[model samples]
Target: MKQYSFNFSFEVLEEFKKLLPVNRSKKILKKYLLNEYVLSESLNDLQEIISETVIQPYWMTEAEIIKLDRLIKQAKTKGYSINRSAIMRDVMNNLVDRYRNKPIQKSKQHRQTFKVPKGIKERLSLLIEDGELTYELSSFIMDGYVPSNDFPSMRNKDQEDLNFKTDIEVFDKMDEISSEYGFKKGGRAKIFRDALNQFEAWLESDPPKKAALKQELKYILTEYKNVENISIIKEEINKYLKE
Candidate 1:
């Protein structure tokens, strides 16, 4: 069996300690692997780590590598560079996927105790925190968002048109819409925001006619499966109706 080792920063390992289940299982590993942005960020962090680093090691037989070569090919076609780190990451991801087909173990053998690095909170409390941030982080992971490299001085120009009070506020709106539509719960906010990006103009237009607003909203709801494009729309329409 060939052993593969992936390096992680102390900080990134802390993040995994928070995000991963206390009783580590291949199932949870598969979930994170499917999150493109999380995987991307993980790989990026490994490259950026200049201080203390940790090694996460996994072993694989030659047959296992050959069996999962298809996934590596698919990733390459999607523009992911073929590198040692990428190959090892994909192999680990593929094993988790393959494990899904095996019979579930009744003896809890699948769940192993995860050793969190120093400076992290206790496992029990971390799980509680994970409950709150999972949805938010999952939103980023599924969306494949890579952070912009623009300097802090240029941020105002990029966000001058943003209407949301905060990024969390945007995710909160997505959570609500997801519940109504029974769709990508906790993820639709970004998608919808980008879809109806004209909300600023729509809100400040002359007269702000309630009837016209409803007509436009009705169209959005139809296309997006009964979703409210954004919370501000409903609030503004209600205020306009009263006037």
Candidate 2:
């Protein structure tokens, strides 16, 4: 991911208003400027959209999935019309972004401030004097003190995205692989890619170096007997020696 420089100042607001007809006060422009943009991307390469996608599907057993449907329904019940994939992307991005300074190398992470109240600066000082209040504490103390700025950087924004794919099945498989491996949300594809690279190096090794098997491996080999099922996507992996 890359860092971006955006003009989120009053000039952007004024300039945007110039393009529109029947506009009113600068207050309207200020609200528009402060609005949180929905993170979105096109499934097809030939379209552009907002929180909405150009268009977007699914599978997996009740035992082998992340239950994304439950999340989508929750969002719907709360009045959001976004698709499940986007919801998942947003959730993953938001989680990662929150702890970004401590994130793995090359992660797209950032936060956004959606709604803040008036006199929050004064309120914050009062809380600080009352005890030691932080942005975290203040979040609960006073309801409208948003202390972050959002970026849609985690999701694909354009045709240049390498991770961009139109196939919903790819994301489904990712979810399944994530569940099978006990990986965190949105991390399945990356871990699988790393495993493939490691396996490729093993394939090219002289006599294929034998590493010590940890208990995790022992458990997988003995108890988690789904290795054969997993190898369907890469059958050659099953041909390797276990010892």
**Model 1 bad stretches (over 4 Å):** 1-3, 31-53, 59-68, 78-80, 87-243
Question: In model 1, what lDDT does residue 15 have?
Answer: 49
Candidate number of the best lDDT: 1
Residue 156 error, candidate 2, Å: 44
Off by over 4 Å in 2: 1-66, 105-243
lDDT, candidate 2, 1-243, per-residue tens: 111111112332233323321112222222332343233343231111222121101112332123445544555665556454454334333333443444322212222222222344343343232222221221121222121222122344221212222223333444565565565654543433333233233223311112112323544554445646555524544555443
The digit string of per-residue lDDT tens for model 1 on 3-117 reads 4445434454444444433224333553444443123433333234233433443344455455445545655666554444454444344444454456234222121122222
Candidate 2 Cα lDDT to native: 0.31
Candidate 2: Cα lDDT at 137: 27
What local lDDT score does residue 61 receive in model 2, on the 0 to 100 scale? 31
